[model samples]
Target: MPPVNASREPMTLPRLTEDPVSPLSPGTHTITVRHGLSRIEQRYHVAGTGPVCIAHPGGPGIGWEYLRMPQLERSLTMVYIEPVGTGASGFLADPRAYTVTTYAHFLRAVIEHLALPDVVLLGHSHGGFVAQRYALDQPERVEALVLYDTSPVTGEEFWSAAVANLERFVQRHVDERPEVARYVAALTTRLDQLTDEGATAVLRTIMPAYVCDYWGREEEFGPARRSLRMYAAPTRGDGQPFDVRDELSAVAAPTLVLVGSDDFICGPHWARMIHQGIPEAQLTVLDETGHLAHLERPEEFRSVMTGFLALEREDAH
Candidate 1:
């Protein structure tokens, strides 16, 4: 993959930032922290007094903004953050520096900095990978794990499907706008060059295709479409090839793996695999839904999550 934001100059941006429409109640104070010279920062949106839940974005570089997951925020004090190189967070100059382990470390830092206990991690897509890894590494820190539309890990076996889908997605976008094919190709190729910061720029340009068939409200879809476009600029020429299947047993947290029944990307079967791997995990297949289950069916998503959280609360009591 090529770099999405490389074409533009790299500047030092705010290490941590706040969301304009935080799901947390007004007057709540959230903190952002910068650790080390790298631009990897964490954004905390604190509210509610029950337990702490950290929300990780999916794309390797996409920030937490795309996922408002307001339902979860309303129930628990939620912390949404930009991965190493996306959003208001600074980008690592080294593209190789962008790996799942480092991202998980950053997540740990956020949890420790906030001094949160009984932390429940809710990660979507790529973020799920992070949450899974974090649980495996720091099982004691995590109270529960919510894997939203992602597998325990991904590898050569899964790359074929992802590659095929991405190729089709890119082809469709290029077909929609032939003139931009070269740019699209270039951007996708540039995915590798992207330090984490460049990932957001790339996603903003190319992520829309995934949602072309998902959202009903064009108004709602419009912003999502724009987000996809930005991320599209960075291409994974060979795609990502890493597996965490062996680490599944290491996750001691009670896990809940949710999937959209109609998710073309990470379907229900994948969710089942996660449930089977994590001995304590529960799987829920959301019928008639797609990849963006939270956005597509917010109310149902909220209900499912709330029920799970409530269960955990009861068990704790």
Candidate 2:
């Protein structure tokens, strides 16, 4: 890994062409980051200006499309990162380099490459883990943090509870919700045998379990099969029992921990754990929301996010 003060060479972004069909025009840029002994390209999309907020999506491998919330563009430039080994990004030679620490390092390289003095990191699910680690590692470079549907740690206790919750959810809705039951069973059975293609398929099948309005708003889930290579990367060792609870206090950035009340995976328990672990982090548990709170409740999520950003700016002066 490069030193904190390592000189970053300028990387040019692709020219943006006007798209009359779309309301927002985002510019795509890619930067090369040296991970362990392998060099990989990290792709990211940039939109809007003012202050920069780098957004990392969950799945560890999922594409950043789901997080391209237009409301955030009104106030801050949202930079959506496509982690290495996924999307147009370069493939990793060593899968072991897919650890959270490596992801944080990749983020730092992106920030440095872009010449961003300070940034606000918005990480969803697994991305939250990366953002937290990044903020802790580079406190001086991170102005604020938004941890959405993520946990401070993913140790045995967390996974045990998550499994228990899934089991209970299954037992309660198995007969009434056949789709949910099938998806849960599939995930439980096929997790070890997941392939790049099968990964996204399984994820889409189980999407309902992660949303609050899955029953009625199932159509809203849409197609999200883009990057699934990173799914296996995490399990390789980078995300095995991922734990960083003891390091939360080292983060100096103003933090917001957002989660859905109905998020069975990283629910209120993880949210409270993060809030209490951080010195003064704010926690918001959105009702009628699930793992995909931003997607499930865009209006409320936007208000909460924009309000926090505004407050952070207000306190700066």
Candidate 3:
């Protein structure tokens, strides 16, 4: 199928509504963006009077709930965007709308609709992909970037290496851990033939591999299941190779490339590539943490993020 031209469609800016007395908090607001045929709704959990931080969750389809860091609320206004095809957000009429570029465009519209003077972008995993694209597309709008557990790009080589690393890690644990062995055995049957619901289940089972202290602290990170079942199929684009290494140089926003020391998917190797690609980008590999470092190590993540934001604020002054 051909990709849809979003330009030709009648685009609607996001509608912002703030409750007189939000049950959750004082500055919480709901912003709904009407795209070509989809209405994307996001929750802006405004906490502090400080800078606005727009956060995007991973999974390309996952809701933003997991990315919520209550600790940072004291220092930053966190706007959690519900990407299209997930949560309160509506589905796109076009499958091609699932691409990274379309997501960036949608995000750009959100920022404009909100009329934010300046903002910081926080993207986790796949969210990092969209954040990077948006920063590249509109460098001026972004005050800074916080990329957590993501890579410069996603292509065959990256996936291949990631899978190899995961296999190695799982193998080492399989002998001593029966649960790990069972999870590995289930992969052959579940991964290749996955329904939307099945995909979520499979992900939850495999999430242990993504964290360092899975055996001891899995529950502390909370359940991996999302409130809404993600549109899994729309997320997997064509097998054609994808990479953004060439475009990284164009991103002018001060970027913080953060990754868990043990994150196999977007590990240190990929973090280094991103750091080397973008000019003046800072890299921090949090020790003993995995892909979900922010959730696993909230205080450390907050310190690292706020520290970067502080420097950006200083520079602006």
Candidate 4:
């Protein structure tokens, strides 16, 4: 994979300048820290009042708003991050330097800046990729991990499976919804080098397939799609393809692999892969749902998550 941001400027690794104490107040905050000689402002929103759970949304681009679990917030302090290069977070000088390693490094820096000894890390989609990398890189810093709707690898095989699954989705709906084929056919959205509007458009176009019953239950999920905000960051590519099958065993954090059974991309197959890779990991698959399991079944999702969190909290003693 190539760098999406075309700037030839130098890239710097994110590092902490000082041991800063930041309270997790109910609001959004930005932390500007050293990224080599450059600086990257880490942006995050805090809500809720229980044990802290750092939630990382996917997209390497999608806004963190969609990943907000209001139900979970009732019990868990949700720290939703607007990853660098997206939203108000400072951009990397060399956008091409974006990779799982880089993201994990920045994530660790931000975590350290927050002064939390360890964190319950929840990552969805591409955010899951970053979480896995971070867990492997700094297992001691991760109190627990939630790998949601993500895969440990990304390449031809991974994408081929997604296409096949998307085709299946198209076939399933084409008979009833004649326009399903058009929606699937028009999905020529480039995975790299996307602008904010372009990323949002691409996601909106594919939302039908991304969620198992998105279109069927439009009234319930319509507001989500209409209010979707995106800030396209550079694709996470540092010349090598993303894969962590062998490295997964190194993750010491207790992990919960959660996914929607009907999720075309990063479905049960990947979930099982992650579950099996991590030692004593738990796997929970929500049936009839797609990528957005939390959105589709908020109560059930929150129940399972809080249950897991409670158990983890107990074991922390």
Candidate 5:
């Protein structure tokens, strides 16, 4: 990775299929996995064999391209997957297929397919919703959880913030490519309808905090470039819909709730709620950061994660 430059926008995203080396450590394979299904492809980078770390991307149509998994992957065999219609994964025309519960099933299949034992499920934002559901469905499969900037409850507040962001983004695009902007505008409007189908595009816009500002290959303006590409992508078919707050208390895995003190969408209050509800969950808020705490504070992120891994290993004995 190049050094950070505050002047120019980042170049186009790196082809995630290529094997990229980690800066923190060496000896890792960053490759793509081909599932039989056309839309089932997953991209991951693996390092050590101590534990399996599976990460879910934040948005409906975005992949885990810019995520700071290299640090973690260098520590363990890390897996980061792009959902259908985003990143390296196959695209789908149906947006309704991106629901929370069905995503859990995908996660379960990935775990079983990989033949992993005692997995660590780490999710950010929307991924947290899926992680929560996965732990509820297959408690025994997960060894630990690290949730960053996730909401404990879902409703208008979430959609409202999403719509607002989309509106601003659409306005910027209107000048550059009116046709694409119009198409995106239609999708954004559909989001206000709040149907399962419309929610997918809106979800795409809501994710990817401007505060994160990390685009892997991009030295600067990485977040802005990524946000633009994400807006134009299509969504996947919808999946099952259900809230898991009532079921959160049943999560058996040791969890670490990592959050940004300045995160507006999923604020400290939500973190506290999740920490209070989960029997073995702990919350840590990063100061002076917004939604993407991991990127804003990568060293801190690794510190908390590595420490928790040590604690879990010690407890297992």
Candidate 6:
């Protein structure tokens, strides 16, 4: 799909292969799993080949395509989860049930259904919150953890700091890139009101700020912005805001904290907090990058990931 304006001709997508030796065999797989009393469809795309790595994409409402990592896929079998309410996945009966904990429940089912006694868990952005909760709640299941472009907690402090940083970013670009102010405004607006299609439009416009230099590299990243599919997921919840700062120290799996230095929301501040909280955690701050480090600097991101995974595997022996 190329942008919202483009026609989405109905087309077929791949499904789980028949009579596979292992469920993780390199291809698409869809399984209906239990999350409490709710029967949900957990559809995941499989690619690459190596140790099983369950990659959870963010957006609680956003589509999973943006998190695709052909780079990391080379060394790790990337199982890209198309989370609930997204394409091919079942929707929640109670929209309010779309919290991180609910997501973790479904994620656990996916791992269990795959019969993965231990698997590497990678979560990005909102998905990171889910990963942390999942890893913290069930430490034994996860072999290692990758928390990318996310924060340990998101509450008053997180929002206030992000607003301050985003204001700075807007002011910096106010003179040269006048349109950035508009984009920033759109980004901060009452996003909860936006429909799924409306969310897609807003996300495309604000996609530039997500990178260190989107306009400079528009040719490279423009396609991603245009093609981004978004669903308006329940963001503002009545439940307590995501906070795992205190619980991070108890995390058993070796963790890697990845964040873009210039990321307005999950910048150096939160990344540092996460680093300090997790004992022996490796923190990689990609300078001159924003929210999407993998998109901004694929090679560097991939190198660090592969290196860390290899080291962890070596240490396991």
- Which one is best on TM-score? 6
**Each model's TM-score?**
0.75, 0.86, 0.83, 0.89, 0.70, 0.91
Per-residue lDDT for 181 in model 4? Answer: 77
Query: For residues 206-284, what per-residue lDDT tens digits would candidate 3 score against the true structure?
Result: 6677778776863453344222244465455433444779999998989999999988778899889989999999999
Question: Candidate 5 local accuracy as lDDT?
Answer: 0.59
Backbone Cα, N, C clashes tallied per candidate: 32, 0, 0, 0, 7, 1
Root mean square deviation (Cα) for candidate 1: 6.6
Tens-digit lDDT string for candidate 4 (10-100)? 1121221232345577777778867778887888878788889998878666666677777888899888887787767888888677777
lDDT of 2 by residue, 1-317 (tens): 00000001111223443333322236777667877676788778777766778898776656556666666777778888877766678867766667787778888888887676888899888888889888888899988999998988876787677767777777777798766667556545434256656655666556656767666754444323222122444334444667888988888999999999988888899889999999989999899887776666878998999899889899998
Better-scoring candidate (lDDT), 3 or 6? 6
Instruction: Go through the candidates in order and give each one's C-alpha lDDT.
Output: 0.62, 0.71, 0.69, 0.77, 0.59, 0.78
Name the lDDT of candidate 3. 0.69
Runs with alpha carbons beyond 4 Å of true place in candidate 5 = 1-50, 160-209, 212-228, 231-242
Off by over 4 Å in 3: 1-49, 182-193, 222-229, 236-240
**Deviation in angstroms for 5 in model 6?**
16
Best by lDDT: 6
Best-to-worst ranking by lDDT: 6, 4, 2, 3, 1, 5
Model 3 residue 119 lDDT score: 80
Which parts of model 4 have CA positions greater than 4 angstroms off?
A: 1-22, 185-188, 191-194, 236-239
- In candidate 5, what are the lDDT values of residues 87-180, reduced to their tens digit? 4555434455456765676667667656767688888877888888888888888999988788766666654654455456557555854543
How should the candidates be ordered by TM-score, best one leading?
Answer: 6, 4, 2, 3, 1, 5
TM-score, prediction 6: 0.91
**Which regions of candidate 1 are displaced past 4 Å?**
1-41, 47-49, 163-190, 193-209, 212-216, 227-240
Model 1's alpha-carbon lDDT is 0.62
